[model samples]
Target: MATLNKSVPLSAYTQFSRAEWAKLSQSTTEILSALEREKLGGIDETISADEVNDIYLPLSQLLYMHMTHSVNLHENVSNFLQKKTKKVPFVIGVAGSVSVGKSTTARLIQALASRWPNSPKVDLITTDGFLYPNAVLEERGLMKRKGFPESYDIGRLIRFLYELKSGYAYIEAPMYSHLTYDILEDTVQKIIEPDVVIVEGINVLQVNKKDRRIPQVFVSDFFDYSIYVDAEEEDIRSWYIERFKLLRNTAFQQSESFFHRYRHLSDTQAYDIAKDIWTTINAINLEKNIRPTRHRADLILKKGAGHRVEAVHLKKM
Candidate 1:
């Protein structure tokens, strides 16, 4: 674990090094194959079976424990009140800066959690689906700020979460396409009753300032557990550039890809563009919104170079 700075005040978390954290999963069986790990990992992300056994297996076990505890707590409260309560989904929020590999983390957790005894159902959703369409963004002149907090339909997101917590049998979320870089107009992803819902996005931890004028409720309120993937700013910037170069050679080659124009660019040109985007947009957003919420998460996964989780910071009960 990274040593805490004496200058900083005491935190509510107890830190654990990677070796210490890995010991917690000694009894958990490895359920994913090498092929599955390759498919789940994002571009430039170096995830392996060892990482699964050391980092994610323990995490899945901890999450399952938390879910069971929550169920028991609800049952006790309902019994005392002499009332019945429906089962509510346990929502987990995964937040981090762009290119921080949060999507891979969320998917791995979902896969491992589902393999537990009884085969509990799990659903994963990205906030990209809740982003405004390209047409709407152009109309509102927010094209450059597409990933900013203002680009999302906060009301719709809140209502969907509220309904889920209200025990809705099924809910639909809009689908977004990375190739088109837009929300599909009539497409929706239906989520049936799930034991766990993992909401993954860069801004999931953001608390909108505009909410103060109305009833105060942020999206993080719906999360039973939250994770913030952490890394140094310089390391993240390099990873973003590396991922961008790889995408130019792969996904950007597709004619329909939003970034197809970059596919033909020389290596130097592409590198410059990637660096500019990182410094101007992603880095700014990280400093302003995402990093401020790291302390708010129930758990923090601190990654080092090569995108390996070196330590875990778990909030003290």
Candidate 2:
């Protein structure tokens, strides 16, 4: 685990040691049960009750405070203008490299935030739902760059966010299936007046270069607060390989799985394929797209080799 340099002058963020950050969790209660944590855990990602208490508990407490303050600010502005206004959802963007546990973090935060008295209606949506269908990607010859920004339906995703922020009565998001490894054309997730919306993905914080010439808005612009999960590149690669192996033994064994063909491969063959995918696709995307936007986040959760959050960096206001 890397420690912050106390002797050096900090510019953008105030770094907190894991022990120091755990103290903030004192004000928040542990509402998640063992079963809930297990359900929220990502593939091959270890998230014990202790990790939740030390990392996510404090994070949830801080997010709730931010939500409360934002509501009060809105109310004050509305009263100053002598007008009544409807409340909009507070959007939190979570961005990180693939297999970095951003999904797990988003789910955990959603659960904790819902339990908070200030915001009871919480919804979690991944930008994976906004990815173009495999058929479309194949047509565009972008199957290799599936997780890249250019591979998404950015225009549609932007419109959805605009509608969500505009306080629309109902918004429908397309569904993506992991089993089929494609966007489901017939299914949609209906979001109805949520108090909080957590959008998690590899490219949530990315600023699209294609939108530069136009007045189109990036997804991060709609976020009230954003989090970027961080870890060493090598550590993330190892985790990705481990997850691939686990899936090979479990999900890949199912005939319906997209990667079912790999189930019959030997351990060495499976390892080579996972390594190739990580190097050619996931790692390249991380270096080129995801990591450059880390500084844009309001908070950063830096993880160590074992996928534990070893330190926290809060952007200085």
Candidate 3:
């Protein structure tokens, strides 16, 4: 773990170095196949067997324990009330800054979680789907701040989660397509009685000013556990720029893609645009919105250079 900052109070968290946390992974089996490992990683992400064994396996193990405990607790409370026990999906929120590889982490969790001995049904959803359409963003003058809190339909998201935890067997969440850079009209991700649902987004841990008042409610309220992927701001900015360059040759080449115009840009132009986007928009969102919620996460995975997690922090019970 990064040395506990003695200057600030951290009594509510237990910090562990990467090696210390890895020791807790008791599962000897490798659950991810080679193709799956490649598919699960993002363009700029480094997802290796070592990372899965050391960081993610222990997390999945811990999540299973939490799920088991919650199930038992529900049964106990139901028994005391002389009522039937209703099951709810274990909700795990993965929150982080853009380019921090949160989506990859969410997919890894869903993958490992579903392969548990009991074969639990796991579903993963990204808040990008909940983002207001690009046209709506343009009309609202928020196109530049598309990933910020105001860009999301918080009420709808809350309602979906509300229904999910209420044990709705068939729930549909809106879907977005990055290729078009917009919400797919009438498209939805069907979440059918999942044992676990992983919600991934840049703002999953955010608690807006209005939410801090009495009768507080936010996305984190629906999470049984949450993970925050952390790295220095400069590192994240570099990753964002690198990913943009890579996408220029890949996703941006398609004529139907929203970013197709960028394919013809020279390296210098691409770099400049990517840097400007980071400095003017993404970085501001990170500092003002995302980073502020880091400590609010149940688990914090702090990364070092090369996108490797070097420390872990678990919130004290």
TM-score for each model = 0.95, 0.94, 0.95
Query: Tens-digit lDDT track for model 1 on 1-317?
Result: 23233235337889999999999985656579888888889979957878999999999889999999988999999999999988799999999988888999999999998987758899999999999999999999998888889899988898989988888999999899988899988899899989889999988888877547677888999999999998889889999999999999999999999999899888898889999999888888888778877877899998988999999999999
User: Which residue pairs show backbone clashes in model 2?
Assistant: none
Q: Model 2 scores what on Cα lDDT?
A: 0.89
- Tens-place lDDT per residue, model 2, 1-317, is 23233233346899999999988887545568888888999878767877888989999989988999989999999999999999899999999999999999999999889889865799999999999999999999999999999899988889999999999979999889887789988899999999999999998888866546677578999999999999889899999999999999999989888899988888899889999999999989988888888888899999997889999999998
In model 3, state the lDDT of residue 31: 67
lDDT of 3 by residue, 25-139 (tens): 9977776877889999998785888999999999989999998888889889999999996789999999999998888888999898987777889999999999999989999
Residue clash pairs of candidate 3: 1-16, 1-17
lDDT of each: 0.89, 0.89, 0.89
> Which pairs, if any, clash in model 1?
none
**Superposing every Cα of model 1 onto the true structure, what RMSD results?**
3.0
